[model samples]
Target: MAAPVITVSNKSLLHDQWQLLQPWFSYFDADGNPAVRYQLWDSGATATSGYFWTPTNAHWPANTTIDVAASDISNVWLRSGSAGGSETLWIRGFDGTDWSGWATFTFTTIPNSLPVATVEDQSLHVNQWARVSTLLSYSDANGDAATKYQFWDSGTAATSAHFWTPTNSHWAPNTTIEVSAADLANVWIQGGSTTGSETLWVRAFDGFNWGAWDTFTVASTNAKPVVAVADHSLHVNQWTRVGSWMNVSDANSDTITKYQFWDGGTAATSAYFWTPTNSHWAANTTIEVSASDIGNVWIQGGAATGTETLWVRAFDGTEWGDWDTFALTTTINTAPVATINDQSLHVNQWVKPGSWLSATDPEGDTITQYQFWDGNAAANSAYYWSSSNAHWASGIAIDVSAADLGNFWLHAGAAEGSDTMYVRAYDGTAWGNWDSFALTSTNTAPVATISNQTLNAAQWAQLVNWTAASDADGDAITKYQFWDGNAGANSAYFWTPTNSHWAAGIAIDVAAADLTSLWVQGGTAGGSDTMYLRAFDGTEWGAWHSFVVTTAV
Candidate 1:
């Protein structure tokens, strides 16, 4: 009879299920009968006795009908345990009296299945720490209560992995772990020098061997600090309270430690360094900068006028951020001070006193206006007179008349008889303090004397030295008038002065016609003639005096 055909359904099973007969078979008995019985055993001689099949009861009755209609064998046995690897199952079937040689089938028993591993991507910044392993997952299909896992970088051995369970120790499936910076650094440094994109690889290992490596990119992210100033414009020598704000952030949540300041593209180290009170680097933080600080760093640094640039940067202990820039303009506005070049003036004089008024501004500002006062008075006071509102306004002409001096004569109480004139300047902003000087006014009249002289009646002799005049105020005697005893009768006989007499240096002259008129008025050439002489200054005339004139015999 043909050996009963035997067919096993599954060729492989887990070693843990070795005690149960999971394999199924189908066949017909050699006696043409449907009844059959079977047994299973290891085919390899080196195989352990555990691979031998054992029956709880004696081998089943040979006539037990192996139902052909049923597709599988139910009670095939392996009382002995099973080992993982290729194994052979030896089976024999029998009908009541006839025996069939054993039919052999080969199958494999697998060890505990390899643990499956997966990892997640991550992002971090320089000097920042994170748990990379927490992003990993592991699983085992064998249902092995104890499955071990280890972490490793790409191109690295599991023996030298970042972290692993103790030797011979195992962890349950789906276990989680946190990979530290030091643990990652063991294979590769995270966040290579710059701040951008990067990648990391991780792999897992079961207790016996390592699984395939899995890759997850680690994005290295870092951002620069943004900075700005409250005020971009400032004045030299002006004290201003300035503030600064900053926006700083890191992907890894790093803390900002300090700040640096820059002036004109150079670091403001040494005495110019500014320290902040608030350790927290954030927006709207008040950075108190005194006016003195501006003067020392900007104004004193030769940025007296125009705009200058300033820069700021933030430090996160390990790295320095990009520099943020701002602008600062320096300005100057100082009032001008004026002084009278000529300290004294003469009253009744049309003087260019304004030419004597000098002014200066510390900021080199142009003098736009000037005001003058007759006496010592504060500028912008009711009594002050506004001069020309033009550039160099202090250089205009001014008249210190007797009326002007007289007004101050009592107010000044000058023993030397002098009035004070005050002047101040304006440089488009405010007026300066008044500067003063003294002025003198006088009304002293000239004294005159008569000199005797003879003149020929018909011969026409010229009269000499008819009169002399002098004034203490250095005023010129402009004219002279003379008359005989009958002043109204000898009106025509009066001497008329010329241009030479109008000068302060020359004396008045008497013409020949005046001599003839004088002689005729005298009634006779031989008789002495009486002439009245007087001098006139530009403003007033002197007292009259009489002089004698004689005709030659």
Candidate 2:
């Protein structure tokens, strides 16, 4: 048989206080309350059948009302017979179609007693205690039988709720946990397991039933503390100021600044002068240097334009004795070499009367001192123990320049011989006779060799080693010059490792790297234009003298 349609006055009521469906004949108690009896079946209007047991809280008067929200799903029942309660109604609802009943109940009954709030009591800790519950739970005074406990913050229940989260919420029995960090964003709840870390919490409940989640948020971050210092340098021309320092180190205080001095990218160790000790090395000090103090400052050519390095350093005092050195470069031009006259002078004639002298260095090393010496030998004089003939230019010429004449004689520092100072000339083609002149050397000059000394790859050449070349007046031979005929006077370049620029040595060594298409020249006196190289082999120094490598190779 089909269950009969039923009706009731109130559609919704206290979920705990009422129940509406009754399919069979039922009786009323002495107070006219619905009887908690049940019948097995339904026949005609007599209506029998279907039995139910009475409920524990079915005795509520008809006028009693309570909220019908999901939280109030228990605490109500009706008595059916001597067995006591039959059914529990979640709310007053029995429309004809659906007979689904409701029961707002607790698995664990609410305790007969209720917890009381004190000035301060925590629920989860030893010293502190609290009374926490969902909106669904109620005290015996509210006709309910379950009890719960948790902290209740003076702030909103939400505060108390989210605070206990990420902690003991899931344990069978609630627990207490200490808070780690304060809520920079939301409450910070710390919890962990014996194994490791547990999960975090999203929401908490304070009422008998939680309405919606009151979500907690993560906190903002804090910056880390650090200690630091700063350095600054100022560069002006040649000098560098490395120690004017100002520092802001940390949040609390500033740090002291230390400084160092460097030359050509290298630092000086000694603290000759310092405001603060250079050893300890601290801020704000100056080392002054003159722009002109930078000597021997030169840069190698061949790098890309403007890619030159400028090096600078201080020379305590002895700049000449190897001081700090630096090299600086510029797009500036090299000193110009200009020619006025035809660049040719006859024997016994001056070199162009007087043309202005001009030439510059790539980095500008001064030509303060000049020399002009005839590169020839005296009568009966050997290559060693020779005469003073270092005039920067000798009677011989490996690389002779038109400008070299002025550079050799006038610019060079050498005394005129007893006869006269002369220069052998190469006028475009063949070698001319000696360029004669008048001058007085204190004594008779030593005889010199003037002969062709250059040779072919497998050819042979001779060498001349003789006695010490003594100066009549007593002047010592500071230096001696010898050139193979391969290097001619006035040529642009001279052979190397064998040219006339060795210290006065009794024996000299020569190699083929020094052989050239041109030959050496006689001095201003004009010696033989064709002669092998010779060094004075004074037995006083050592009787060692050698000719060109061409002699052996």
Candidate 3:
């Protein structure tokens, strides 16, 4: 049933139901029945004591519908308590002056007649006090109830309306998606993923609840939903796979004004999302939606292991297309596609200390490559390519020529950090599985470290502890050493040094009791005395910090 546009002023009867009953005095006229008398009216109608003229009484209805006409609806009167008088009248929603036809209602039935109807301006709200006796006096021949009334929702409900519903009273797209959770992000759509070029609504969610779905149109050209989730924003990418690349538009067909996205599930509008125009995705790559088209929209990969809900629509320029269904599995934010079977810089003892990097995308996509130079530019950079011998991501190696030492770098190459590659298939389907990290040349060996040796002795014969420790060969020190100092109950280590070869190799814990060691070549003066430690490799002599024997007091 349609709700009517009827409205009532409701001003006159707002509080008029205050006094619907009045007290009365009566006696039983020798019959076994109680009598009541009311000979006066308070609207200036006076009373007389001799004659009696009163309203006829009848059995009242107990909790039933009241049938009355719309015209004479205001003529009904309701009696108050067991008193002699009644007051405070209301006529319910029947404001039309004539009680012509009939209406239905439900009311209560007391043993004696009570103040059923209050003569007022308007009808009562549902489930309010009603006059059940009024319906008894009016009806059609066939007992058919004839009245028109309605129930409505004047902007109050248990759930919020959708944005695509176009009520014009809800939030608009382009709002930031600010909701969050530890699990992967999700997006919801108003009328999520319906058939054809119809509008696809967007909102975000985890698997549990959802945010509002903002509506956006799809391309008229052949298009399908490619959904992905980010910070809080959703990305809805649409494109068709062709060869090893895709045919995509910077802007979708005439349906959406501008792409938008949400951060988490919040409807925070923004235009900062990924686009194929920024980095043309190869054909075999599965492009997820960026945070551009809808608010809080997100998509997950179907080829992987997780599942997520996403909002999206597809269009073939004019006709609505089928909604693409895929299981959503969230992944880490990947930068680009890197294709190599073996890392070029990898070293292995089994491979004679030389191994070549090998890489090949099933689609045969190539990267302008550069590798770290170990020898001189010509000695290390040329074997198959450039003027000098070089190694690519394949099973190729350069002989450790004499010209390579102290000369290596992470040099610039033919690709940038944001480049992406696609995989081609025999079935005309594009594969979006590989993204690579930016590559540059890095160093060859570890840097060096050194320390200042501090030797203390209780007597010139027995050394206490030393503090000077440093590494010239700067790969984190893996070993350490303690010379001259005895290992016993009195021995205590002084300062701590990084782990090193001397520290990591021939190093032994010292106890103060082993003071009988007598290898100090004579240290009465500030002359260089030999400690058991040998210089690192003896090739580059490490600068020594000498310790002097103090004057004996």
**Which numbered prediction scores highest in lDDT against the true structure?**
1
- In model 2, the worst 10-residue window by lDDT is 41-50
What are the Cα lDDT values of the candidates?
Answer: 0.47, 0.27, 0.26
Give per-model CA RMSD.
40.5, 34.8, 26.5
Write the residue-wise lDDT of candidate 3 on 43-111 in tens digits.
211121111112332222322233333332233333322212222111222222212122121111122
Cα lDDT tens digits for candidate 1, 25-117: 555654577544554445544333234333444332222322221223454444322455665556565565554566666656766565566
Q: TM-score of predicted model 3?
A: 0.21
> If the candidates were sorted by their TM-score against the true structure, best first, what order would they fall in?
1, 3, 2
TM-score of each: 0.31, 0.15, 0.21
Candidate 3 residues lying further than 4 Å off, grouped into runs, are 1-244, 247-465, 480-546, 550-553
lDDT of 1 at 137: 65
Candidate closer to the true structure by TM-score (higher is better), 2 or 3: 3
Index of the highest-TM-score prediction: 1
Tens digits of lDDT, candidate 2, 1-553 = 2233222222222222333333211222333232222211111111111121234332343323432222222322332222112222233332233322332321111212222322212112111112222111222333432222233222222212223344444332123332322221222232211112122122222223322212222221112223122321111121222221212122212121222223232122211222222323221233333324222121122222332222213221212111222232323233322222213222122232224333333333222222122434554221111123422233443334454434333321133333333443332222333333433322333323333243333332232222234433343333344533424342212223345332222223332232232232223222223223332221112122333322211
Count of clashing pairs, candidate 1: 0
